[model samples]
Target: MAASRRLTQFALVMTVAAALAAAGCASGLGGGTYQRTEARRTMTVQFGTVESVRPVLLEGTKTPVGAGAGAAVGGLAGSTIGHGRGAAAGAILGAVAGGLAGAAIEEGVTRRQGVEITVRLEGGSYLAVVQEDEGEQFRPGERVRLLRDGGTTRVTR
Candidate 1:
């Protein structure tokens, strides 16, 4: 039972890691790149304050190992309470109950929450970025400038 629980935990961690890797790959492909220009330029930038922060809940799927481990542990515990056929039957019933409880607990704990930030670009483009850090804050109508290879992307208030 202990071995099964350990394996289940490892599998869950691996699955989550894979999903995070995939998401990172996807994001790396999406951000646009700025080319360096020969000319020098200055620009004014505008910023927007975060009106609201929303947590995005990612749905998680179930793993059979979690249930199996739960059942095994439950059965073992249940078997200790009775004798003969009663003990055997109790173990089976306990295993089923434990499996369900384990599954529910795993599901609840593995859920991930992401923060979405809405920013207004200077050129009137609205950009939303999902970030793991929720403590970062940007004020609305703030002026900011980015110096890139001579060309500047400015956000003006």
Candidate 2:
């Protein structure tokens, strides 16, 4: 009976952990992509010439979901190793280690390669925009377009 209960608990913990991870999946930040809310909204357009393009790393999100799921799974696995006080100590250690690993994995999975494009507008002013690379290449002196929606701006050829 005790073994059956433990198995059930383990299954439940795994299910919950998978659900949390799926919920935290990151969305694309590419130039061609648009969020649902951004559709049908008017954006101001401006013309520019690309002055420079540099590679960048876009950082991933840091959220509680990953840490929480890891801790729960680790604690459950640790508790099965010993009895009473020993089990408690093992759970604590396991949870700390699991939480750290989970956070690192989450960040690594969502990290993306990006580009910083510097442009000189028609008015002799310079502006820079960073966006996910998405296989789009830019060169110095190439003509580009800048689209602005509220505080967000993107560069496109």
Candidate 3:
């Protein structure tokens, strides 16, 4: 009975160890036997020059109008503070303050337009390039090179 009990305990321990080892192996802990892939891509890019620059106004912006209205209200309040000469001085000061506030509000709502470049790819596909600051310098109808990697992804030129 004693020998049989000892054998059973040993068997249980061995089974537990084997399970733990198998779990570790499956989780990529036993050895680094994982495959690595290279980052490869292919893309076509066209170059173009900046034709025009403009302000891209933000939508749903009420800053400028709100500022103007707020200014008017402030001016009216100031004008109320003084009689005659004081009222006139307050009105002038209020107008100046309102104009500055309105300008600031408008500036916040305005975004600078990016340069637009037009390019044609090999399959006659046209692409429009819009970039901030520096854009690809290619003239209209100028020949440009397009590069593609294995996966045929487009990269910036």
Candidate 4:
């Protein structure tokens, strides 16, 4: 009986964690039109020569998904462990631990490495653009297009 209860709780916790992760993935996408904070304008295209290419790791930002999931799971598991006062204490500890673990997991999942391409424009000026390395590698001295749209910019072949 006790073993079955423990198994059920464990499964519930796992389900909650999976749901939280899926939620994160779903909310990550933004609708197109334009963001209120983003600059509104047409893309300004310019030709440039790649001056350098360097690899870089982009840090991930934390969200409540992990902590929230962790807390719910921890609280549930903790509730099963003790009597009234002890149960409360266990829940608190579990929540803190779960939150920390969730945050770490989120960071790990979202973190990515990319490349910074430094391009020297026709007038001898330099600009660097960092983007996801989608296998479209850029080499020094290679010709490319720099597209600037409002406050955002991108480099392409």
Using lDDT, give the best candidate's number: 2
Write model 4 residue lDDT over 1-157, tens digit each, in one string: 6886888587766857684565456222111223455555567888999999998886665777766776777776776668899979988988788778777777777766678999999988999988766667889989999887757677888
Preferred candidate (TM-score higher): 3 or 4: 4
- Assess every candidate by TM-score: 0.45, 0.87, 0.31, 0.79
Off by over 4 Å in 3: 1-67, 110-120, 123-128, 131-157
Report residue 30 deviation for candidate 2 (angstroms).
1.5
lDDT by residue for model 1 over 1-157, one digit each (tens)?
6785577557546654544443333211111323354235453334554444455664444666556656766676666556899989988898889789766655555454555546655566766655443333435444433222333332212
- Which candidate, 1 or 3, has the higher lDDT? 1
Among all windows of 10 consecutive residues in model 3, the one with the lowest summed lDDT is: 26-35
Superposition TM-score, candidate 3 onto the true structure: 0.31
Q: On lDDT, who's better, 1 or 4? A: 4
Instruction: Determine which window of 10 residues in candidate 4 has minimal summed lDDT.
Output: 26-35
Better of 3 and 4 by lDDT: 4
What TM-score, to 2 decimals, does candidate 2 have? 0.87
Task: Name the better of 2 and 3 by TM-score.
Answer: 2
lDDT of 2 at 113: 97
Instruction: Sort the predicted structures by TM-score, highest score first.
Output: 2, 4, 1, 3
The true-versus-predicted C-alpha distance at residue 9 of model 1, in Å, is 19
Local error of candidate 3 at residue 12 (angstroms): 83
Top of the candidates by TM-score: 2
> Judged by lDDT relative to the true structure, which candidate is superior, 1 or 2?
2
Colliding residue pairs in candidate 2? none
